[model samples]
Target chain A: MARILIIDDEEQLRDLLKQMLSRDGHEVVTAFDGVDGMRVFNQFNPELVITDIIMPNKDGIEVITELLCRNPNVAIIAISGGRRAITAEFNLESAEMLGVKGILSKPFTRDQLREAVQHALGL
Target chain B: MAIKTKNIIDFKSEAGRILLTSMGALLLLMVSAVFLSSYLETQLGSFKEVVFLGLAMVIALGAQWFLLKTIQSPQVLSPEERVHTTNEKLRHILNSITRQVESALGIKNTAVGGIENPADMLAATLIQCVAIMSEQVQSLLSALQMGSNESLEEARQSFIPLIDKTAETITQYLHVSQNIDNQLRERINETQQLLLNLRRELATVPQNQQQDTSQLFACIRQMGDVLETHLLIDNVVKKQLEVVTHDTNDSAFTLITLMRDLSDQAGNLVRYITETISKINAMENGVDESVGYIVRIGHFIQDIPEKIQRDIQAIQSASGVIDSLSYLVDSIKEISFQTDILAVNAAIQAAHAGDAGLGFKIVADEVRKLAVNSNKAAEMIEAGLDTARHTIHEGLKFKFLEEVMQQMNEAAQMMDSVKKLQEGHEDMRQYYKTLFTVINQSNMKLAQDISEILGSIQYQDIVRQRIERMQAAMQRRNELLQEFAIQLDVTSGNNMDDFATALNAVLNGYLEEESYHGNSLNSSDDGDQPPKFELF
Candidate 1:
């Protein structure tokens, strides 16, 4: 099983993801935002990472770029719900350009989340 | 005749210009009157003539004063020119009133059109109306200044119409302004009603928010209760699994230890059994040889008595022959003794016959001596033969044969003991073979039971993982409800665009990974498709 890191500001979402992946016999870690995710990423060095595109303090695109810089082989899955003048789609596109391996929309089902995680990890 | 009168009159006017001739006539008349009066005074009295002259001079003086006064007065202007002057003043006043009225109308038009502020325009229109009324009053006062009475009446008539027209225009402007004011009031009332409805809606927002929060809290509490129950059950199951696994491992260890010990013992047992069987076989072979030798010894002992009986018969026969020889020798001696007596008498005689007797005696003596010696030999032979017969009559050889028979009975008894010992060794070999087979079957059954127990303990790990996932999913759902509440409050006063921006910013804060796809995310995506797996 792979070790996975879930980064999101929604505390509930982070907990849910951690539980789901851990159930599959993988080690799971959680972070509340992009900044916290980066800090934990260095400590955990998980095989896969799931992140959100629109964020405060640090956005998903920046996180993706920085994470890739640190470890090019790190797997990433980006999630978002579009908002405001900067759409979720637009932000997600930018994240894709920055090098994310997978993408999922907000409010995804457990199966979809697992698929995205598994695919990113090369499970 | 009238012509002749006219000609005489013309002759008279030609001789004197009328006023000059009249004055000259008056002077002439005065002079004549004076003369007449003098003559009358002379005829009547002097006072009458003097009074008439005085009256004539006073009348003349009054006529001259009237004529000079008429000529010296200011020149009279024409009635037409005075009417024109009064009409000009009225025109000027009406023109000013027209301009003021036009300005008021323009302000009212602006107010009605809603271009300018209505209140400000209304004030300006009122001022313009007041100015128009004041200028109309001034035009009425100027109309009284006409020169001729007729021209004064005409100016009054023209000025009244102009003043009335100015008043009418001012009234029309006032009516238009009033209509605009009514419309403005109605619009203000409608705006006030809209504000009141907005205030009532704002007041109900807090109640709605509180109700939603309460519902979310209840859901969270229920989740917490369920999670507690799950945890308790999980712990119990985990402990049971641990115990089972530990027991299985111990059993396997015990089975292995027992098998090893059994294997060593079985090896020892097999070696012992084989050695015992070999010794028993050797013993059985030895017993066969011993039993055969005992039978042969029994046969040899049975033959020993017969051989001893044969030896006893030969000794008895030898004794009988010795007795017969003694008897014959005794008989010969007796006959020889008689012959010797006779031969002695004869020998004396034969001594005489001795030569012949000598020859005969020699022969006889020799014969007699031989006869005596023969008698002596027969007696000795009979003595020896008697002793031999007596010794042979005793039981010395039979005693030897009886001792041989006694030894043969001891050998036969020893052979019977050897046969009993061989039968006992054969019984022990059969008992050892049955014991080895029973122990080998018991050891195999113990090894199989331990293997089954070890397999049951590995399934517990998967169950533990599933319980943990359920707890996490519930907790996350509770947190999402809280976020939705906060988002609702934030967007109540702002527009939809601003709310969208705020909500997106908050949600984006949690993102952790790299995004590799375009924003094709649909929140409402529903499908029956199963998940896909890949090897990265």
Candidate 2:
């Protein structure tokens, strides 16, 4: 399977995703937030990126702005929490605006993050 | 590039040769010209003054040719030389600027050592720097109008504004330097006030004799450009020496304070010692002394608490003593240095004292011996303090109040676990508050340390160390705004010629990726994952 990256602040969930992806024989890199997520994506040139919508410093919006400026070909899977937490949190519509191929919400089972990454990579 | 720059008149270099040649030949020609002209005017019976003047000019011209002519053809500057001359002037201007910058740098170095008195040194330094940097408007005219030979006219027209702009930078720095100096002076005065407060609380110091001496030295260190031009004054009046003196005094001040406080505490201990001696004497009296309250008092509940408090007080006093002694050693050294110089001055002044100076010499000798005794006693006190602290630390470190608190936390946690056995739930609340306070104190201390260390490092120095630190961070941030200002004035894009392009096609070159280390972000139009935390 092609390498995939997951960017999330939740350590527990990132760990779960890492385990599930490597089981599928794909190389997995995890980033804590949009800032490091973008940095890792640039350096590693990972075939696919799966990122969360909210982050501090350089947030998901900033990461998207910079990445598309360099290359438009890279595939992406976006996940969101919700506006119920804060109006700033990402929604499905903004993910569409950013050109994400797939979108998901939190409280999704292990099957969700894994299947999203697998589908985006065409594995 | 040519001897054209070397003119016969430029006595700045060959003054002696120019003076000798011009004075000798020119004077002879002029005198002969005047005599010939007057004689010819009388012969012509006024061929009018015009014709007589013409004949005088002719004779003067003939004599001047033989006398004033030189092998070098009286070198005047060539076109290239005009540029070099202008540049040379610019170099002098920059040199002056650099000297000021160096002085500022020197003062900055002094400030680097983390002393309470660096403010004074830095303020004086800024003043010197500003004087050097505060270029006049005339220098702007020179930097701008004085173009090199190749593009003299064009440079004169276009570069003047840049010179003006550079001048503006100097002016800005000057204003800032002055403001900073004022603020720094105020801060030093505040520090001096703090020092004065400590001294005042000390009560028994000889400040009347000593205060003026330090104040005078402080004034000398604060000398600016007027002092800097005299290279010796600027060079000798270093912040480093001031800082060393500062460090020595700081240690000594701390030493004196701690010693005084501990000595008072030692008096308290001496009272207990006297009591113990009285108890033994009472025992020897054998007057039914089985009910001696002193030994019994040590075992009582209230007495145990009092004894523990006393022990803690003793430890605090011991720590104070150690601190005081360290400072005492340092202060003594600095004062001795000051006194030595004063002594030398006095001795010189003593030579001129005549009979009246004998009494003053005696006073000086006494002062020196007093200084010696102060230094010796300070050393002994410091050694004693160090030994005492070592002994106290051995007994106290593990069993400090924190250990007692830890046991309380353990009992509280246990009690909370078995809350059903308790009559009230409010007991757990108190424990929680106590724990919170401790944690909050710990965090506050950490924050204080971070602020102190980072804030203490000068911002400009860090900026100079690596522009990339700020620039790189800014660059990353700039990408978000999507409008990073690329200075296009210099225009450093691929300057490929037509032939080069053709050659490149022949060689089949390919485009390369830009390296930005790990600073890469894939297009995540599909947002995923949770947000991360990063401090600003």
TM-score of each: 0.25, 0.20
Best by TM-score: 1
The weakest ten consecutive residues by lDDT in model 2 chain A span A83-92
Q: What is candidate 2's TM-score for chain A?
A: 0.84
Q: After superposition, how far is residue B411 of candidate 1 from its true place, in Å?
A: 10
Give the Å shift of residue B117 in candidate 2. 15
User: Can you write out model 1's per-residue Cα lDDT over B327-366, one digit (the tens) per residue?
Assistant: 7897888788887877777668766653565555554566
lDDT of 1: 0.49
Q: Which stretches of candidate 1 lie over 4 Å from their true place?
A: A1-123, B1-234, B269-307, B338-367, B379-536
lDDT against the true structure, per candidate, is 0.49, 0.45
Off by over 4 Å in 2: A1-123, B1-81, B95-255, B280-536
